[model samples]
Target: MLCIEDLLTLELFKTLPRNRLDWICDRSQILNLSTDEILVSEGDPARGFFIMLSGRMGLTRRSDGMEMPIGQHEAPSFFGEIPILTGDPNPVTVRALTDCHLYQLSSEDFLTLLHECRNFEQVIFKTVAKRSRGLESFIRNREKMAALGTLAAGLAHELNNPAAALVRALRDITPALLELQRMNLVYGQHQVDAEHTAQWIKARDEGYETITHKRIDPMKLSDREDELLDWLEDYGVEDAWKLAGPLAEGGTAIATLEELTARWQDDQTKMGTMGLRWLALSFEVMSMISSGLRGAERIAELVQSMKSYSHLDQGARQLVDIHEGLEDTLRLFSYKIKNGVEIRRSYSPDIPKIWAYGSELNQVWTNLIDNAIDAMNEKGILEIVTTPYSDRIEVQITDSGSGIPQEIKSRIFEPFFTTKAVGKGSGLGLEVVRRIVEIRHQGSITVDSQPGKTQFTICLPIG
Candidate 1:
């Protein structure tokens, strides 16, 4: 238990009226944390404030996905009071810097404490307001550095493309290098005459092109080289080397090219199974480039969506189609959905659009759809239906799979409480969805869950 009087010595709790202080003292619970335990994470819903009782805690900001410590709080300082006041997700993650004890008052309990203790509420709000302003300023400065993240996801593709080409170019070198080694080995061992070896080299050189192209007509190639050599002799050329430059030095380069081109003029399939393999690798590289571009494009689009969805560009809200927002959002998630799911839409063809922050509402759709897809375990049917009411448009996203567990449904929208395996989810999604719906669109969201089905509903008021 945390007594208001005991915490009052802390600057953050000092201003509460004695009665108000006692009210807070009555509701707070004490929790113990082991070293390295996570207290709060970035984007987690702010449940209430925490006062570190007897150990160190770290505030970590996730930038470039590196959890750099932004600050540290020692015993007697409170945290999370800022986001609780502003209704935004907690932007910093707080983890135990050492084995520690903490006093926690959940947001639900805080409401009752707040109603009973105006003085305590005022102290918390005043302290958090100053912190909020500072955080806002920090956020603006950090936003600039975020461009590096954008460039990284974008420009990193430059490396992937060249890296993929190198993989192919290396594959082609294997046989050629081996053949060269065999040549030197045989000749160095005195196994053949220089003239015989030169002829063998010439034949091997011709075969390099033929077999690579899998043409392999040894006699035909020998006869063609002979015919070409004979023609050069008719023009008073003797040495094959002496005639080489003149043949190529004149327009005969084009004639040789024409001869080679005629041989290779067969369709790509003429290389038989070998050609199919080469084509497969070539297409694979092309696919890597395409997928990388798509990933980079998606990151850029998310930044755009983030900027537009907030629409700080212009302050006033206006009429927008929720489905249009959902449709565009769906495009961004095409890869995730297309991998293993069937989507069904039963939208009312004529529902009126609602007035709200269009992009923010799109996030609501995105978050819901993301959860619905996850609920299906990435495989099953997803159904979306739009219905018009007297004053609101109701949208339902449903999935066929295991549903939310009953024991934890009440806390599903609470921040940091996710059933997802570590690293895959942060548990902030539904909480963000709740805020976007209630705060931005003045809408309502609810969920109905069962063993093989889970449906999330969104109702946005019409203008």
Candidate 2:
């Protein structure tokens, strides 16, 4: 339960009208959280204010592979105070380090109360000062980390081409080895006896000739064996004595060296591709991956998709087909969706291309569809319908899952506003999506909701 004193102590509301303050306190609720429970997290939009009623609360920040503790507010203190003071997206995460009881004030009601009173402005100013210090520290640290991230990302991008080539090269090796193996068998069959092998040799050569004519000799087997052995040694094949007789008898032994070399070459290509991918991601988001488990490719890809979707590097917009951007984003998120969801796609034929930002638009689609899949827990129906809207195209993304609450529908577009569990969402996703659509693309997105039915309709001018 919220007490009048809690609202009374905060500087932001010191000047609020007594009646409005009373109204806010009356409406506020006390939420008791168990140990390790999250109260609020980074990227969740500023709701109102979270004041610690009792117990301890901790703020954690991710910096350079370390989870550094930022600030801990004990009972009678407030957290997420900065967002309420600044009315911006909350950048720091607040969690209950121990069992805690917190009084959550509605941003709307709190602001209404603040406006009605003038006596407490001084107190509000003081509290804002306290919270601002902590926020400044968090930002300073984050910016520094982001810088290191840029250098690393550039390095990753520079390495991508080689890696891509390696993966591509490996893909072609399977067929090459198969062709070589067939040649080996033909040579082995002719190795049995010289006179008896002549007819077999002629037939084998003719067969090989018909298929681009590669020659092999059963008698020249000695030379081939020497060549094969040298190649194997180069490939680290140490157990040659035992491998020799069978290989000589079957003529297919040389294929192992080829297979090993192919795999090795392929691995090089794959690893190189990863670096290039990270580099590409950095180009989009500009060092968003300086922190987190980037050693794991998931974080890298997340950074990549985020960067691509943001279009941070360029503000310019051009004509784009939302469907194309949507498809590209889907490829990025397919792994996550595949875990349990059966995706249903319904793209309209000849989806008119609209003027838009190619990458940022990708993010909007990615965030929306990703959320839909999550809403369904990766199962249930997800339909993306596109129809011509005279001068624009309208997209209706509906899912068979829990729908948004009517009360929170408006808040969903607010920056950092989220309804997901801690670590599961930044709450900034939809906020960013809406930003790109409305502000950047000069488009509109609306939502309608009911049980198991929520539709996000986006309209973008095609001309």
Candidate 3:
């Protein structure tokens, strides 16, 4: 049983004249909702209009298998008008926050009131517009945050390997250096002849040069190490096996070790053999230091790429080299692609810089490249082609994965539409790409696909 008095209590109904209010009360149905009850579900057919009478209701939209509250409705508030006006399904699920009373107007009656009352129509439509704008704003921000989270996770994973190498290098180098120093001090106390010392120094320097400058064949080095191991054991050098790897890596032949240890063999003490051991260990330490430096340099390079990709220290809009941005994004995503994906680049060497939002352009590249990697299931060839057009530059990213199906291609850029599994996508990736390319950079993006290949082309004006 619906009453005129209850209808008048709602702000939207208050604006309607007495006759219209009476008409609405007669056509409307009274609905009572218990706590946690569902009012309308997302994607459900637009049934009618609702005006809350008492208690509260919460609106939520599904993303990544979770219900995310996007808006709410309380007593005297109205909803369901948006879907009715647009003739579309409900965009959000509405559930009761508390036991509630509401008035539901049929689509026919809701339309009649919309047409017949000027003030009532104005208020309802305005509220619809305001709510729509607010929802859009909220979702847009959420999209950016989600994208940032994805990028951040990818960046952390990519940085970890090189960073760990750098740490291990630093940790191991100190002890090796100290051990080498102790060996040097022991040798220095002995009154060794200058000529013998010179011979030892020359041999040590040559081994270091060979190890640092020349790459040894692993098979040949293994044979050489075996020969040296047997020779050192026969000559009575303690733990001869321990010196074999370093001496082999340092290009120390059995002849070289035999000649270097000749003087110590006659001595009752094994100082000469000890010196040879120290020299091989020293060469090994040098190799470690070299590798550590390389790891540190790699870490520095990745950090710089991350900074450039984000344009953290740069202005919002600037003249940017498109290839630079693309490369930076590739570097950040390298961890994901490194296992099996092969990247091919074809850049027109002279492509000009373009004025744009540098970071946004990077985001565009990130999304497209990331999507391509996923499309390939992380094990196909990805090609980036850049061509200079008249007053613009065209960049294409192509992946050797099964192309997007024709039926869904047209709707791919629609917000919250995705082919990815639940919990793996928010469905805003391509929408963000479209907004950045078309709205932020004044560019055009187009895609072409087939069974084996899909290419996304972005054209940006040079001016």
Candidate 4:
């Protein structure tokens, strides 16, 4: 049974006159809920306005495949107004935490009261605004954290291969250098002729040049390996195949090996094939050093790209090269893009750097590129084009994917609006993009879409 005393417990009900209070008491139905019982679920239709009289309830929203607690409601609290007012589905689930009693007012009756009482309507609208801001704030923070997690994971993946190569280079080079020192000691003991030693030195230097420069044609490398292998076997070297690859990669000729090893053939000591072993080992070391250097350079490149993309060292607003920002974003997303996406870039060579919020602009690029990749399901052509004008610059990102539907195109930039499945999107991505471009940078954005192509164009002031 409903009573005037129960309605008065809430301050909001106190705003109404006696007759209106009586009206609410007559129209509101008593609803009892057991602990853990759901009153309304996220995405459920607007049921009505609810006035909590006793006990507590929990509010949770689905995000990233998990139910996240956004807030709680205690006794003498009121809710269920946001959805009713907005005429939208409930954005969160409400579940009783303890046995509870509440009054559910039909939408029609709530609206009638809202229109009839100015004070009641004022209070309700204020509460609605506060709650909306709170929910938006929580979800926006979650969105930023989620985006950071994704980029961190991608960075780890991209760093792995080169880091491993670097470790292997450091690990293996030490043993090979020690072995080469021992070989040199043995060769020095022989006190071979100066002319003979000069020939070996000349051959080793030439091989180093060839390996470092990558002078050998890959197509011809296999044939060279075969020739070296056959010559080493004929000369009685054990495991001749092991030495062939290094020798061929160094662009070693059969004649050079013959000339260098001609004097050592008759010597029964390790000196017999020492010349051949020395040359192969030397070439292998050179190859390792080259590979290690390349890996280090790649690591440095990725690190620099990330640093530039973040604009950590720069001020909030700086002269930003739009192409650099785009390139950095593409580099970060390379793991996703390389799998199946083809990127086509066209930038006006004369486009000048513009004063803007550099990092925020990068975020705009990140969200758009990320959405473009997903829209293509990781397999399609992503085209980026930049055109410079006297006063402003226009950047376009186009993807070959199923286009945005015509009906929802206008609402695409609205906050909390999304076509992505639940838990797959926060629905704030485009909203953030819009804010950064239009509000923060005083830029404009527009989208054009069709069956196979969707392009988002952003125009920003150069000054």
Write one digit per residue (lDDT tens) for candidate 2, span 1-463.
Answer: 5767876655555666677767767887778999998877666778666667678988875444455677888886765556776666666667888999777778776665556555544566666776665655454445334433532453355335445544554554455455445544654653445653453344333333322223246576566557656654564544544334323333434453353235235553342222222222222221112111233354455456545544557566766757766765665555555567666778889787766778666656766886787788777887888888578888888988798888898889764456764444445567667777888878899988888988899988777
Candidate RMSDs in Å, in order, are 14.0, 15.4, 2.8, 1.7
Q: Of the pair 1 and 3, which is ahead by lDDT?
A: 3
Give the per-residue lDDT digits (tens) of candidate 3, residues 1-463.
6777877776777777788777777887889999999988877889788878799999887765778898889887777888888775677889999999988988878888888889988998889889987876776777667667777888788767767777886888898888888988888899788998888888888888887788579999999889888988888878888888888888887777778787678887779778878887888877777677777788788888988988888889888989999999898888889999999999999899889999889889988998899899999999999999788899999999999999999988986666765445656788888988899878899999997799999999888
Q: Which candidate gets the maximum lDDT versus the true structure?
A: 4
User: Model 1: runs farther than 4 Å from truth?
Assistant: 1-57, 61-70, 74-316, 421-424
Rank the candidate models, highest TM-score first: 4, 3, 2, 1
Candidate 3: worst 10 consecutive residues by lDDT? 418-427
lDDT of 4 by residue, 1-463 (tens): 6889988888888878899988888998999999999999988889999999899999998988999999999998999999898887788899999999998999989999999899999999999999999988888888788777777778888988888888898899999999899999999999888999899889889999998885788779999999889999999999999899999998889988888877777878857587788889999999889888888988998899889988988899999999999999999899999989999999999889999999899999999999999999999999999999989999999999999999999989987778876667877889999999999999999999998999999999987
Q: Compute the lDDT of residue 330 as modeled in candidate 1.
A: 62
lDDT of each: 0.63, 0.60, 0.84, 0.90
Poorest stretch of ten by lDDT in candidate 2: 284-293
- Model 1, 412-433: lDDT tens digits are 9875456764434555667767
- Candidate 2: count of backbone clashes, pairs at least 3 residues apart or interchain: 20
* lDDT for residue 73 in candidate 2, whole number 0-100: 83
Clashing pairs in 1: 211-214
Where model 4 places Cα greater than 4 Å from the true spot, the runs are: 215-217
